[model samples]
Target: MFLGIDVGGTKMQFAVGVGEDVFVLNKVPTPSRYAELLQVVEEHCSEAEKRFEYAGKIVEMGIGIPGTFTKERVVWVPNIPCLEGQDLAGDLRTRLGAGVYLGNDAQLALAGEVWKGAGRENSNAILMSIGTGIGGAIMIGDRIVKGRRGAAGALGWLNLDASVPGDKNHGYLENYASGTGIAGVGETHVPPLSTYEIVAKAKEGDSFCRKTMDRAGHLIGAGLASVASVLDTEIIILSGGLSEAIETFKKPMLDSFIEYAAPGVEQVPIVKSELGNLSGAYGAVRLAMVRGDMWIG
Candidate 1:
């Protein structure tokens, strides 16, 4: 059996699978501290084993974290600060007594898509996840590009304005195209609205909300165009929370993407994630399946 875990900012998802079928799944709120996070995982594992009647069966595990890491430690995790500078993989392996594999959540999502989702038929594709923040991965053939330091897929930091300095907010593509960015679109209200609220308002025919979403789509498209100019991948798969609002942004995103894309690159297809939010978990399964033979980082 293979166990997959996705550690996100607000939630942690766990899945157990044998071959291509996932037999068990669970979700829990993410704890703020590393110790609590570990405990939560352990508890979930125990519960899943009991619930699935897989007690005593040996299993390999794969974990996906939303940040960059080295072979021995996680160096940066913006949303989950407690994990920064920690040896998460080592700790998990020691506590769980299982062979553990670690990978970036975005890259893992791409792996899942490649294995059984939208990217299954495409050898070269890009998975761009636009949620609280934007994360991306580039797949060339069967392998994912994991730069020397495993930060190759941190596409959110891509500069959208050369003159502005890259920071947590403002200059990067993420600052303008992510869920947080979408929420910040019209901040004039006394109490700023959330991304969902903005989408709801737009659906109700609010012109300002509609225009804001349109702008976000255009900016996202421009960023994708930049990526295409460089990688020229066969397809672009959009994932994350905001992707649910694809109808509100697809046209503008595609328009700007094509307008800025170089020559034939514009013809590349852009599609929604077929795996939805489960891509990371599925990718974790893939990671566990190939644990000893491949280097995820």
Candidate 2:
């Protein structure tokens, strides 16, 4: 058995994995302070130890962070500000009295796909996580791309419009295409519709919402086109809350991709995540399996 934690801006997900099956333990609101975050995680770990069948059978643990991290320290977590510069893996190890591994959430999500979901048969793949913010991860010949500072696939910052100034925090692509970005567009006309509601309205034949989603889909496709051209990815996987609207986004996005992508790149298959939101948790377990030492005691 293994423990996997996926940390997000709004919520934190916990799961336990045994063999090929992964079971979610619980979810909790993410804390804003570093100390509180640690306490919450420890509490959950204690509960899992006492309540779950795995108990003493658990071998290793893995945690997925939404931002950049190194072997021992979390270098930069923008959404969860308090996590920056903390030695999260080390602290968790001490608190749990077991080995803990850390990985970038997007990267680990892709790992989960490769291990048990969509990318299982592909050695070269790309994943775009498009929820509150956009994140990316690339697997080239089975090796995950991690740039010098472990920020290689920070796709949200991809500049689509050079003429206008971009947001220093969320970046250009995220400003117009992410879930928050989509909701921002809806706010002007619909007055408080969420991205999901906007997509629903579009599906229900609302022209205004439909057009809005089309534009966003086109933009997302353009960004994906650029990525495909550069990486020559075998497959592109989409995950996150907004990906549920793939039915609305697919055609326009594919059309836009055909318009902008390099010749053969446009043919690359784009698919939804098979593991859905749990991809990160499964990937966390894979991370532990690959990087952590087996517990013998």
Q: What TM-scores do the predictions have?
A: 0.89, 0.90
| Residue pairs whose backbone atoms clash in candidate 2 | none
The weakest ten consecutive residues by lDDT in model 2 span: 288-297
Error of 2 at 193 (Å): 4.5
Please report, in order, the local distance difference test score of every candidate based on alpha carbons: 0.82, 0.84
lDDT of 1 by residue, 1-297 (tens): 678888888988888877667653878888999999889878877776677674454377888888888765888888899999998878978988878877889988998888888988887889899888888898886778776766677778778778876585434888888888887775765567778888888878788788888998998999999998899799899999899888888888999999999999999999999999999988887888787234433
Query: In model 1, where is the ten-residue run with the lowest total lDDT?
Result: 288-297
Over 4 Å off, model 2? 50-57, 190-194, 292-297
- Cα lDDT, model 2, residue 248: 81
- Candidate 1 has a TM-score of 0.89
Q: What would the C-alpha RMSD of candidate 2 be, to one decimal place?
A: 3.7
